[model samples]
Target: MKTRQFFASLAAASILLAVPAFAADSAQAFVDKAAIGGKFEVDSSQIALGKVQDQSIKDFAQMMIRDHGAANAKLATVAGEQKLKVPSALDAQHQGDLDKLKNAQAPIDPAYVDMQRKAHADAVKLFETYASGGDNAGLKTFAQQTVDTLKTHQQMIEKIAAGQDAITGATTPAVKTDNTPNAAALVPGANSFTEAQAKSRIEGAGYTNVSKLTKDDQGIWRGHATKAGEGLAVGLDYQGNVVAASK
Candidate 1:
């Protein structure tokens, strides 16, 4: 039993451990890992945007591009202000992941989503550790702010993977959730997002022709919409949950 447990631990540590490993050592190490990992998210999502067919995956990729691009820029500013150099390129491991995605054949959505899930897990570990125990105040604060988005990314990828696996068919995506940098209750409540902002967020989740949007007393925005050639009853809750049900 001890031998089996020991090997299991080693095997688990062997996968995607390098990224988080860097962040555990020092402030400089954390910065390097964070920057390189952010680069990987943006670059790979750009590839997915071109190749992946599922609208959910495409929407997820778009979110990743926008969020990580912004996050990377924020990290750059923080790094410069703190006099730390952010790495401009993906390291060996991440570059290898990107190359694999590029070479993957049609129906790349599964591969892309799976890669995102694992990558985001590692990223969450790196950021959470740095946020709580890093050596620098500025970098720690950045990590603190960025980790939640990483977690939401992980959750999104997981749903994508599960949605794809629901059938032995093509990689159809699952539920589309908005991780739009905010802290609102999962249940409806006084929504802070404006009506236009709500529509934009819902549209960003891949719904189109959105109309009849009205906020209920519960603070959930309910509306009509279309997705993947099918009309859906769409609603946006305070927590950025853009749910689509059959009409």
Candidate 2:
């Protein structure tokens, strides 16, 4: 009688364990969703960065590539370990998001840091939901850990996007100094200027002996200037903006 009771209790315990396992099958769904999200992030990041002209936006793109790619790898390893089957591609919802992102309509400006911030926000929310609600113990733990990381990334994106926004509204107008020469020959759409024309413009602006003009890689022209310790180069753009005045 004692042996039969022991065996019955053991069987009940085994059944209890099996119940959670069945529930954990739902983890496969979250895993698939994460994989799809990660892929869309990486793809959209690279493609949008290509169209972006802002330096800050370019830096954000690099971060997305690094963070999202790492997350995908970790998820892939976990999927392999658990024998979870992930989708080869995103599902309808994720695919729709990807299409919107590719078209720059989802984030409103694919190259902008705000776009990345919003995307990361969405990703963080998704991760949080799954991590907290996932059925599988392993995936639940993984999701919890990912939520922390995603929150950190979300903060970074927010900070950067905020900085970018500040830059938009906070540009200081260039102060015209007596020493700054007017060289209207380097603006993007400016007409060609001969050495004589450039020298005339420079000399007319209280500059002396503004000769020996050289062109930089971006087709901007520069003249030589002697500062405190050494001879410096003064790069002037087509609109005569002083791009760089350094040695």
Candidate 3:
């Protein structure tokens, strides 16, 4: 009976010793799967950003490659010790993004900033979801760590898009000359036409048949009107509240 109890005790000790190996193997398997997924994701981004013309995007892509690639290598070492396998390629959605970015290599429109912003936004969402919901503890931890990085990237990309919009919106047409005075060169002084000066000058002028108005290359205000039988050009001095009459 003593021998029988001794045998059972040894069996339990063996099982306890084996438990750690099993756990280690399971942890490695989970980490391996995650690394595989991350590898493809990083590869897609590297190729996509490589085609971008923006220096910022290109620099960021280089960073992603270095960081994620290092993490993948580390994971491979861990997985190998536990006899686990990592996936060798990306999924369909990532492939699609890669293709789109590649095709946009030519010209590389500034509007591509919008595409980058959206992509980062989606990535943040995906990483956050997986980090919280993944079955493996190691994978979940890795994902959680990755989520912070992805969210930061999303914010940066959004700022880039906003900058592009501001640049586009602030653009104004170049001023063109049409016998109009170069009003842009005029310095505002005591004799300059203020809002009140302009309003008073136009109101008091006995101008008739005024069809078009413009400034001249010499900082003179010119107006066109049908006078008598032909178009006559007249200059007005809003600063003096008077018309210089056609000269």
Q: Quick one: ranking by lDDT, best first?
A: 1, 2, 3
Score every model by TM-score: 0.59, 0.54, 0.47
Q: Compared to the true structure, candidate 2 yields what TM-score? A: 0.54
* Per-model tally of clashing residue pairs: 0, 5, 8
Ranking by TM-score: 1, 2, 3
Two-way lDDT contest, 2 vs 3, winner: 2
Q: Global lDDT of each model?
A: 0.78, 0.61, 0.53
Query: Which residue ranges in model 1 land beyond 4 Å of their true spot?
Result: 1-25, 169-247
For candidate 2, give the lDDT of residue 23: 72
Worst 10 residues of 2 by lDDT: 166-175
What tens-digit string does per-residue lDDT give for candidate 3 at 159-194? Answer: 545434433432221233354433342333333333
Clashes of 3: 8
Highest-scoring model, TM-score? 1
Candidate 2 ranges with C-alpha deviation above 4 Å: 1-22, 100-115, 129-133, 167-247
Among these predicted structures, which one has the highest lDDT? 1
